[model samples]
Target: MLAGKRILLIIAAGIAAYKSLDLIRRLRERGVSVTPVLTRAAEEFVTPLSVSALAGEEAHRDLFDLTKEAEMGHIQLSRVADLVVVAPATADLMAKMAGGQADDLASTLLMATDTPVLIAPAMNVRMWEHPATQRNLATLQGDGVAVVGPNSGDMACGEHGPGRMAEPLEIVAAIEARLASGPLAGRRIVVTSGPTHEPIDPVRYIANRSSGAQGTAIARALVALGAEVVFVTGPAEVPPPEGVTLVKVQTARQMHDAVMAALPADAGVFAAAVADWRVAKEATSKMKKTAGGLPVLEFAENPDILKAVAGLEDSRPALVIGFAAETDDVIRHATEKRARKGCDWILANDVSAGTGIMGGTENAIVLISDAGAEEWPRMTKTEVASRLARRIAEALEAG
Candidate 1:
C-alpha cells in the first residue's frame, strides 16, 4: 500500500538504533525509498556506513556539511519526503522536539518539515514513566505527531517496563496507516473499550466479562482506514492495538473523564461496559472476615458517559454509537436505549447463558437506528468490527 512513497528516517541515539537497519530493509522491500539521518550520539551505537548500505543511499550526518548543503538545502530536504520517522527516539530527543529546539540537523529537519511525524520511543523504565517525559509526549501528540510503541519488556539497562521501541514490522504498519488515503483519512475518532472496575474495598471490585476484543479490532480497522483514533481503554484482557493514542483508566469516573477530555472528535464508539454503581464510601483497608456481621455497603450511581456526550450542545461528536449487552428483550430494550441516550446508533447483542459471545471470539449484532432494526448474522468479532468501521466511514462521508 505504501509503494512509491519516500520516507526520511531519523535514527536517534539508543541501543534500539540497530533495529533501524532492518526497518530500512523492510521499507525497501515494500518499494519505499528511505533517506537515513544519524545523530552524533547515534554513531556510537550504529555506524553511518551500515545505515547507508542498507538504505542504498548516502547517510546524512553533519548539519554543516558544505557540499551536501549546496546540493540540497535543509528546508528543501525536509519538505521533499512523504513522511518523517524517528526510531529509537531518546527521551532527550523527544524533549527537544517538544520544546522546538533546532540546534542539530535532526531536530532542525523535524522543525522545518511539513510532513507527518511518527516516533518510536526508547528509554529507561524510569525515564519513560517520569513526569517530564510524559509531558513532552503529550505535547508532541497535541502537535499532531503519531506514536507507535514503547512496549513493555526487558530493557538494555537491565530494567523491565514500557521503554522498548516497537519491532520493525510494527513500525511499517504505523507508517502505512499514517499515509493511507482512505475514506476516513482526516477524521479523528474516540473509542472506549473494556469493562470499568468499581472498587468495593482495597482488593475487591465489580467488573464484567467483557474481553475488549471487539473494541480493539474496531480501533485497528479505523486506523487502517487512516483515522486518527484516541483509544480510551479499561483494564482489559486484550492488549491495545498499535497505531493509536491510548488512554488507560480503571474506574467509571476515570473513563468518563478521559472520554470527555478526548472530545471534539468526528465520532465516538462507546463499547465499554462501565459499572452502573460504585461503593459510596470505600473502606481504606481491606475488609476482613470478622465476628461482626457482613458489612453493608451503600452504592452510588456512576456517571452516565454516553448520555452526557450525546446531550452535549457544543464540542459533541457528529456521530455517537453505543453498545448494549442484553440477556432478554434485546430489540425492545436496545431501541429504547437509543431513544433514551439520544445517540445516533446502538449495537445490541445477546449474552445469555449459552451464547458464549461475551468473552468469546464471535459476536451476533443487532444494529438499531432511526431507520429501525437491522439484524446481522453471527460472525467473528473482527468481522463485526470491520463492517462497523466501513459503516462509520460511509456515515461520515454522507454528512
Candidate 2:
C-alpha cells in the first residue's frame, strides 16, 4: 500500500534522535519516499548531512530562509506529503503543538498541513508522566492525532520508568499502520495474549515463557488497520499498546471469560499461550514442604476457548484463528489442533529452548489451513503481526 507514498519525517531534539536514521532507512527499504525536517534543537543531536544521506533527500531545517522559501515554500511542502510523522517528539515541542504555537518550521508545517500526523514521544520519565504532559496528550488524542509510544525501559538519563522512544523498527511499523486503509474500520477484533498462570499455592504457580509480544503486536496491528481492538492479556512484561481496550487476566479461565464476554466480533486471534491443565483444587493456604516424598497435584483441563468460540452459532466471529506452540513436529501438531479445535487457521511455531522464540523478539511460524501449511521465515514479532494482518485482510476481502 506504501509503494509510492510520500512521508514527511520530522525529527525533534532528544537523545533518541539517532533512531530517526534507522526509521528513514526502513521506510526507504519499503519503497516509501521521505522528506526530512529537523528542528533547530534537533540539529544539536544529529547532523543534517547524516539525516539527508539516510533519507536520500535534502533535509529542511530553517523556517526563515528567504531563498529556500522562494524555491519550495512551506505551504508547498505541507501540501505534497500523504502523512507527517514526528519522531522523538520532545516535551517542549508537544506543548507548543498542542497550544497552537507555531514559532518554528516543523510546528508551522504541522499546523498548515491537512495531512494526518503521528507522533512518537521521547522524554524523561518525569516529563512524560507530569499532569501537564498528560493533559497535552489528551488534547492531541482529542484532536485525532495518532500517538505511538514512550515505552518503559532503561533510559539514557540513568532513570527508568516510561518515556524511552520506541525503537526504529517500531516507528516504521507505526507509519505503515497509519498509511493502511481501514477495510475493517468499523469492525471489532478480540485478541488473547501471553501465557496464563495456574496457581499451585499462595507463593507458587505454574506458567510458561510466552512473552505476549506476538499477541500484543497483533492487537496493535489490527488497530492500525482500522479495527477497534479488545486486547485480553495475561501477566506480561510488555504493556498493551495505546488506543485499544485492554483486558488483563492471569489464568486460563479468566482469559476464557474475557474472550467470551468480548465476543460477537469480526475476528478473533487466539494467540495466548493458555495453560492446558490447571490444578483441580487450589490450596487456600501455602502448601507445607514435604519431608519424605514429593507432593502430588491433581490436574484438570482448562476451558477450550478457541473451540468454544468456533462452535458458537450466533456470536462467533467471521474468522477464528488459533496458535500452536510446539517443540517437535510443529506443522503436524498445528494441523491436528486446527481440526480438533474447529478453527479457521492455525499458526504454528517451534518454542524449543535456546531458540529464543518463546519470550524473544523474533519468530518463525508456519501458517496451517485446510489448503496447506505455509512456512514463514524468521522475523520480528511486529513483522509477523503485519504479514498476518494483511493476510487476514486479504482473506476477508476474498470472502
Candidate 3:
C-alpha cells in the first residue's frame, strides 16, 4: 500500500535520530518517496548529507532558505505529502507541536500541514514521564496525531524506562496502518478496556480481575482493519495496543467522562469490567486497624457508563456493544442486560469457578442481539477480537 506514496520525515534532536536513517531506507525499500527535514539540533547528531543521501532528496533545514522557498514554499511542502512523520520526537519538539509553535522549519511545517501526522517519541525516562510531556502527548493524540512508540527500555541517559523509539520496521508498520484502505477505513471506534479502580485511600483501592487482554486485542484488530480507535483503559495488566488515541483513567466516573468526551464515534465497545459501587465517603488517610474496630463502609452506585452512552439521544453511536460476565444463565442475563442498557449487542461469557475465562487467554462467547443468541466456539482472545471487529464492520456497512 506504501508503493509510490510520499512521506515527509521530520528528524528531531535525540540519540534516536540515528534510527531515522534506517527508517528512511526501510520506507524507500517499500517504494515510498521520503522528504527529509531536520531540526537545527538534529544536525548535531546526523549530518544533512547523510540524511539526504539515504532519502535520495535534499534535506530541508532552514525555513528561510531563499532558493528553497522560491522553488517550494513551506505551506506547499507541508501539504504535498500523503503523511508527515516525526521520528525521535523529542520532548521539546512535542511541546512545540502541542502548543502550535512555528519558530523552526520542522515545527513550521508541522503547524502548516493538514495531512495526518505520526510521531515516534524518544526522550529521557524522566522527561518522558514528566507531567508536561504527558500533557503534550495527550493533546497531540486528542488532535488526531497517531503515535507508534516510545517503547520501554534503557535510555541513553543511563536511565531505564519508556523512552526508547520504536524499531524502524515498527514505525513502518504503523505508517502502513495509517495508510491502509481496509473495510473499516475512515470509521472511528471507541473501546473501553481494563478494570476501573475506586480509591479507598492513596494506596488502597477496589478493583476486579480484568487483565484487559480482550479489549486490547479488540483495539488491535480494529486498527488492523483500518479504523481510528480511541482506547480508554484503566490500570490493566496488559499494555495498550499502538495506533490508538489512549486515555487512562482510574475510577468509573473518570472512564465515563473520557468516553463521553470521545463521542460521536461510529461504534462503542464497552468491554470494561466496571465496578458497580464505590465507597460513599473515602477516607483521606489510611484506615487504622487496632485503634478503631472494623469501620463501617458505606457504598454508592457508580455511574452506568454503558447505559448512559447507549441512551444518548444526540451522540449515541450507531452501534453500541457491551459485555456481560455472568455466573449463571449467560444468554438470558446478557440479553436482558442488552435490552435494559439499550445497547445493540451484548457479548456474554461465563466467568464461573474453574472457567478461567476472566483473566485467562481463552473465551467462549454468546453474542446476544435482537435476532437471537449466537454461541461461538471457544477461541483465543485475539481470534474473538478479530471476529468481533469484522462483525462490527459488517454491521456498520449494512447500516
Candidate 4:
C-alpha cells in the first residue's frame, strides 16, 4: 500500500515541524514518494534544503515561484498525488482548512485536491482542547479527513495532555490504511468486539474479561486486506484500528442497533462477549448504601444479534461468522451453536481458567462450519485474524 504511492506532505508551522523532516525520511524508506510543501512559518524551524535533501524532491515553499509554477501548476501538482498529508497540522492551519481558506500554496492544494487528506495535529494541549479547535477538528473529520493523533503526553511547551504529534511510523500506518488495496478492496465488513457493559447504575456496570484483542486484530486484518470494516466495539481494552468505520456501543441492545445500522455488509464477524441478560430496570441514580440490604435486580434477556442477522430473510450478509467461547465440550458446543444460530461458521475457543484465551494474547480455535469442525493450533490473536480474514476473502470471492 505504501510503495510507489505519492504523498504531498504539507508541513505546517509548529515546534513539531522538525518531526516532519523525520516523517519524510520514514515515508521514503517505505518507497513512498514524498513532495514537501512548507508553509511560510515552517521555514523558521526547518529549511527547504534539509527537506529537499531528505525527500530527494524540491520542496515547494513559495505560492508563486515562477520556475516551479511554470513546470508544475498548482492545480496539476495537487491532482498528481494520491494523498495529501498535513504533518504538524497546527491549530491555525486546521482552522483555515476547516474554514476553506486557500491563501497560500499549501492551503490552495488542500482545497483544490480531491485526493483523500490525512492530518497529524500538533499543538499545545490547551489549543488542542479549545472548544473552537475541537469544533474545527470535528468539521474536518466530518468532511472525510483522516486524523492520526495528537497523542496525550508532556508537550514541548512543558504542558501535559494530548497535543504531541504522533510518531512518523504511526502516520505511515494511517497512510497504509487509506491506500490499502487487495481482493477485498470494495468489500464492507462488520466486526463486533469487546465485552458489552450492561449498566447496573450510572457508575456501575456488568462486563466480562474480554480484552477485545482478537476483534481489534480482526478489524486490522480486514483493513489490511482492503476491506472497508465497520468496527462495532464495546469498552475495549485495546484501541480500535485505523482505516475502519468505528462504531462504539455499550449494551447488547446498542451493539445490535449498531450492527444493523452498519449493513448491508458483505460479511459479519460476531466476536463480542455480550452478556445474555441485562438489568430489567436500570437505576437512574446511584443506589445508596444501607438503603436496600440486598439489591434484588431483575434481569431480561438481551437481543440475540448473531441469530437476528444470520436468520435475516433479506439483506443478509454473504458470510456470517460467530465466535463461541466455551469452557467445556468446546467442539460439540460450537457445532451446536452454528446450527442453533443459523450462522455460516463459528470459531470456538477454550477460555477456561487455564486456557487464558479470554483476556490473553494467544488463541487456540476450532473453526466450525456446516461441513464439520477443523482444529487449529494455538497462535497469536493477530495471526488468527489474518488467517480468518484470508479465509473470508476466499469465501467471498468464490461466491
lDDT of each: 0.91, 0.86, 0.91, 0.88
For model 4, the local distance difference test gives 0.88
TM-score of each: 0.81, 0.57, 0.75, 0.64
User: Among these predicted structures, which one has the highest TM-score?
Assistant: 1
- Tens digit of per-residue lDDT, candidate 1, span 1-399: 989999999999999999999999999999999999999999999999999999999898889888778876777779889999999899999999999999989999999999999899989989988889987987887687887777768988899977889889888888888888888887888999999999988899988778999999999989988997878999899998876767778899999987876766899999998998999988889999989898898999999999999999987899999999999999999999999999999999999999999999999999999899999999999999999999999999999
Candidate 2, 208-289: lDDT as tens digits = 7788899999988887777656678899878877555556688999899878756667789999989989998889899987
What TM-score would you give candidate 2 relative to the actual structure? 0.57
Question: Which residue pairs does candidate 2 place in steric collision?
Answer: none
Better of 2 and 4 by lDDT: 4
Residue-wise C-alpha lDDT for candidate 4, range 120-237, written one tens digit per residue: 9999989987889987876886576777776667887899876888878777876787778798876778899999999999998888779999999999999889886778899899
Q: What's the true lDDT of residue 350 in model 3?
A: 97
The model with the greater TM-score, 2 or 3, is 3
By TM-score, the better pick of 1 and 4 is 1
Candidate ranking (lDDT, best to worst): 3, 1, 4, 2
Tell me each candidate's RMSD, in Å, in order.
Answer: 3.7, 9.4, 4.8, 6.3
Residue 89 C-alpha lDDT in model 2:
95
